[model samples]
Target: MGTMAALVFALLAVNILLGSYTVTIPDFFAMLGGKTIPGASFIVMENKLPQALLGMLAGASFGVAGAVFQTMLRNPLASPDIIGISYGASATAVAAVVLFGVRGAGVSVAAIIGALLVALVITALARRRGGTGLILIGIGAAAFMQAVVTFLMSRADVSNAQELMVWLTGSLNSANWERVGLLTIALVVLAPFVAVGSRELRGLSLGGDTAAGLGFNVPRARLLLTILGVLLAALPTAAAGPIAFVAFLSGPIAKRLNGGAASLPLSGLVGAAIVLAAHFVAVNAIPGTSLPVGVVTGALGAPFLLWLLIYTNRANQGG
Candidate 1:
C-alpha cells in the first residue's frame, strides 16, 4: 500500500514537472505561489495538471468500482468495464450526443442514469440466478450495450461521430478544473459508503450462506455494493470516457500485491497509479503520436485477460 501510494505521487510529480513544456521544480512552485512563467504556466495550469489530477481521481474511482464488483461476485473477470455497466454509460452518452444533441455535463448525466438502470437490471438477474450467472449475464449485457453504441455511432452525423469516437477511445485531453471539481464532489459523497462496505465485503467473501449465518443481510449488502460500484464507475466514465481495463485490472493487480486478499482502498491506489503511468506513456510513447490512454490500457488488458482466463481454467482443473 505504501509503495503503491508513493508510485501514484511519483507519477503525478513526473507528469507535472516533466512534460512537453518543462518547468523547473522552483518555477512550478513559484507558479503556485503567485508567479507565472508565460508559456509554461498556461500549459501546466490549464492542461497537464488537470489531466494528471483527473487521472488520479478517475483512476481511483475505477479501481474502487472494479474491486467492489470483483469482490462482490468472487470472479476476477467481473468488472464494470467487462460487464454491461460501462457500456450502459457509453451507450447512453453516445445517444445523448448523437440523438438528442446533448453536450458536456448533460452527457455525463445520461451516462450515470444509464449505468444505474443497467446495474439495477443485472442485479435482478443476479438475485434469481446466482454469482456465476451474474457474470455471464453481465457479459451478455455488455455485448448488447456495445452493439447499441456501435449502431448509434454508425448512424451519427460525421461531426457528432468524430466527437463520439474521441470520447469512446477515452482520452484525458479534455480534462479540466470543472470535471475535477465534479469528480471530487462524487468522491466525497461515495467515500463513506465505501468505508462502510469494507466489513460487508469481508463478510461476503466468506460466502453467502456463511455471511447470512453471521447475521449479515447478504442480499442488501450485495445491492449496496453494486450501487456503490456503479456510481464509482459511472462518474469516471462520465468524466473521461471508459478508460478501458483500469477497472478490469486494478482489483487483480491489487489482490496480487495484497497477497491474494482484496482491499478497496489499495485497489484505488493501484488504479490511480495505472492511469497516471498509462497517461504518461500515451503522451510520450510515440513522440509525435499521442494516443488515447484507453488504447494503451486496452492493449495491456488483452494479454492479461488471456493469461487470467488460462490461469483460472488451470486452477479450476487442478482443483
Candidate 2:
C-alpha cells in the first residue's frame, strides 16, 4: 500500500509537470501562489493539474470497480468493458451528444442511466444462469452496444463525428476542476460501501453455498456489490468517457502483486498508475503525435488480453 501510494504520487508529479509545456516545480508553486508565471500558470492550472487529478481519481474508480466485478464473478474476463457496461455508457452518451443534442450534465446522466440499465438487465438474465452466463450475455450486449455506437457515428456529419470520436476515445483534453470535484465526491461516497461489503466479497469467492453457510446473504451482498461496481465504472465513464481497460487490467495486476488476493485499494492504485502512465506515453511516446489516452491504454491492454487468453488455456489444459 505504501509503495502504491508513493508510486501514485510520483506519477501525479510526472503527469503534471512533464506535459507539452514543461513547468518547473518552483514556477508551478509560484503560479499556484497567485504569481503570474507566463505560460506556466495557464498550462499548469488550466490544463495539466486538472488532467492529472482527474486521471488519478478516474483511474482509482475504474480499478476498484474492475476488482469488484472480477472478484465477485471469479472470472478475469468479467471486467465492465467486456461485459457491456462501458459500451452501454458509451452508446448512450454518443446518442445524447449526436441525436438529442445533450451536453455536459445531460450526457453524464445518460451515461449513468445506460450503464445501470444494462447492468440491471444483465443481472436479471443471469440470476439463474451463474457467472459464466452473465459474462456471455455481457459480451453479446457489448457487441450490440458497440454496433449501435458505430452506426450512430456513421450517420453523423463528418465534423460531428470527429467531435464525438474525441469523447469515445477518452481524451483528458477538456479536464477541469469541476470534473475532478465530481469524481472525487463520487469516490468518497462510494468508499464506505466497498469497505462494508468487502467481507461479503471475500466470502463470495468461496462460492454461493459456502458464502451462505458462512452467514452472508449472498444475493443481497451480490446485488449491492454489483450496484457499487456499476456506479464506480459509470462515474469515470461519464467524466472521461470510457478509458479503455483500466478496470480490466488493474485487478489482475493488483491481485498478482498481492500474491493472488484481491485488494480493492491496491487495485485502484494500480488503475491510477496505469492511466497516468498511459497518458504519459500517449502524449510523449511518439515523437510527433499525441493520441487519446484510451488509444495508448487500448494498445497496452490488447497484448495483455492475448497473453491472458493463452495463459488461461494452457492452465486449463494442464500444459
Candidate 3:
C-alpha cells in the first residue's frame, strides 16, 4: 500500500511537471504556488492540471466500476468498454456534439441516458437467458453500437468529423475545472456507496444461491451494485469521452499486485496510476502531437487483452 501510494504521488508530480512544452521542476512548483511565469500558469492550470486530474478520475471510476462488474459477473472480460456501456455513452455523446452542437453538461446527460439504456438492455437480456448469455449478448450489442458510431462519423462534415475523431479517440485535452469539479463530486458521492456495499458485493461474488442462503437479498443487492457501477463508469465516460481500457486493465493489475486479493481499493489506485502515467507521457514525452491519453492506453491494453484471451482459453482447456 505504501509503495503504491508513493508511486501514485510520484506520477501525479511528474504529470504536473510535463506537458506539451517542458517545464523545470522548480518553475512548475512556483507556478503551482501562484507565482506567474508567462505561459506557465496557462500550461499548468488550464491544460496539464485539468487533464491530469480528469485522467485520474476517469481511470479510477472505470477501474472501480470494472472491478464491480467483473466481480458481479465472475468474468474477466466484463468491463464497461467490452459490455457496451462505454460504446453507448460514446455514441450518444458523439451524436450530441455532431448533430445538436451540444457540449458540456448536455453531452454528459446524453451519455448517462445512453449508458443506462444500454445497461438496461444488457440486464434484460441477461435475465431472460443466463450469465453466459448476457456476455454474448453484450458482445453483439457492442458491435452494433460501434457500427452505428462509424456510420455517424461517415455522415459528419469534415470539421465535425475532425472533432468527433478526436473525441472518439478519447482525449482529455478539452477538460476544464468545471469537468474536474463535476467528476470530483461524482466520485466523492459514489465511492462511499460502493464502499458501503462492499460486504454485499463480496457476498454476491459467492453466487446468488449462496448469497441468498447467507441472508442477503440477492436480487436487490445485485441491482444496487449494478446501478452504482454504472454511475461510476458513466460519469467519467461523459466527462472524458470513452477511455480505452482503464476499466479492463486495472482490476487484473491490482489482483496481480495483491496476489489475487479482491481488487477494489487497489484497482482504483492502479487505475489512477495508469491514467496519470499515460497522461504524463502523452503530454510531456510526445511534444507537439497532442495525442490522446486513451491512445496510449489502447496501445498497451490491446496486447493485454490478447494475452487475457489466451489465458482464458488455456484455463478452460485445463479445466
Candidate 4:
C-alpha cells in the first residue's frame, strides 16, 4: 500500500513537471486552483494537467485489465493488447472517424463493440484448446486487425491521414477534462466489482476443476472477469487509441516489484506509474515534437515481450 501510494504520488509529480513546456510545482498547483498565473495558466490548466490526468487513468485501467486477464487465464501473455482487443478498439474508432464521422462517446461505444467482437472470435477459436492455444489465436487476430488498419491508412486523404496516423500511434496530446471525467466514471463504477471478485480470481489460478471443487462457479466467474477486463481495455483504447503494451507488461512488472502479491490494486498502481513515467519521458525528452506516449511504451514493451518469451521457453525446457 505504501509503495503504491508513493509510486502514484511520484507519477503525478513527474507528469506535472515534465511536459513540452515547463512549470514549477508551486505555479502549477496555483493554476490548478484557478489562481491565473499569467503565462503559466494556459500551459498548466488548458493542456498539461488534463493530459496528465487522462494518461494516469488510461494507464491504470490498462494495467488492471491486463492483470485480470493474465490471472484469469493463468498465462502471462494474456492481455487486451496481446489478444487483439486494442487493435479491435483502434480499428473501429478509426473507421468511425474516417467513414461514419463519429467522435466523442460514440467512438468509444464503437470501439467497445469492436473489442467484444474480436474477443468473441478469439474465444471461439481457442475453445477446443488450452491457454497457450488461445494466445496463438489472439496473435493471429491481432495481425489481421493491424493489416486492416494499415489498409485504411493507405486509402485515407492526406490531411485526415495525418490525424489518423497520430491517433493510430496512440497519443495523449489532445486529452482534456472531458476524457478524464469519462475515464473516472468508468473506473469508479467498475473497479469495485473487480476488487470484490479478487477471491474468485485467486481460486481461478488453481485451475477450473479446483475452482469448481472449491464451490466457485468457474464459468460464471470467468465470464464476469472477461467482461471487466474487456471494459477496462476498451474504455482506455477508446479514449487514447491503443497506447501499446502498458497492459502487456504491468502485471508481471508489478508482481516482480511486490514479490507476487496477486492484488489488483497493487498492480493497477504499478501500471499507473509505468504509463505516467512513459508519458512524462515522451513529452519532456522530445522538446519540440512531443512524440506519442504509445511509441515510447511500445519501444520498451516490444523488447520486454521478447525477454518474456525467452524466459518462458527456458522455464519450460528446465521443467
Please report the candidate that would top lDDT against the real structure: 1
List model 3 lDDT by residue over 225-246, tens digit each.
8888888788898888788998
lDDT of 3: 0.84
How well is each residue in 167-282 modelled by candidate 1, as lDDT tens digits?
Answer: 79888988999999999998999999999998899889888999999999998998799889999999999898999999999999999999999999999999999999999999
Tell me the lDDT of model 1 at 181. Answer: 92
As for model 2, its CA RMSD to the true structure in angstroms is 1.4
Residues 164-238 of candidate 2 have per-residue lDDT tens digits of 788788877778898888788878988899897787789998888999999999989998998889988988998
**Which one wins on TM-score?**
1
Off by over 4 Å in 3: 24-26
Global lDDT of each candidate: 0.90, 0.89, 0.84, 0.85
The local lDDT score (0 to 100) that residue 216 gets in candidate 3 is 94
- Per-model C-alpha RMSD: 1.3, 1.4, 1.8, 1.5
Give the lowest summed-lDDT range of ten residues in model 2. 282-291
Per-prediction TM-score: 0.97, 0.96, 0.94, 0.96
Residue 140, model 3: lDDT of 85
Clashes of each: 0, 0, 0, 0
Worst 10 residues of 3 by lDDT: 281-290
Q: Tell me model 4's lDDT, rounded to 2 decimals.
A: 0.85
The stretch of ten residues in a row with the least summed lDDT in candidate 1 is: 15-24
Local lDDT at 120 for model 3? 93
Predicted candidate 1, C-alpha RMSD: 1.3
**Candidate 4 weakest lDDT stretch, 10 residues:** 13-22
What residue runs in model 1 are displaced by over 4 Å at the alpha carbon?
Answer: none
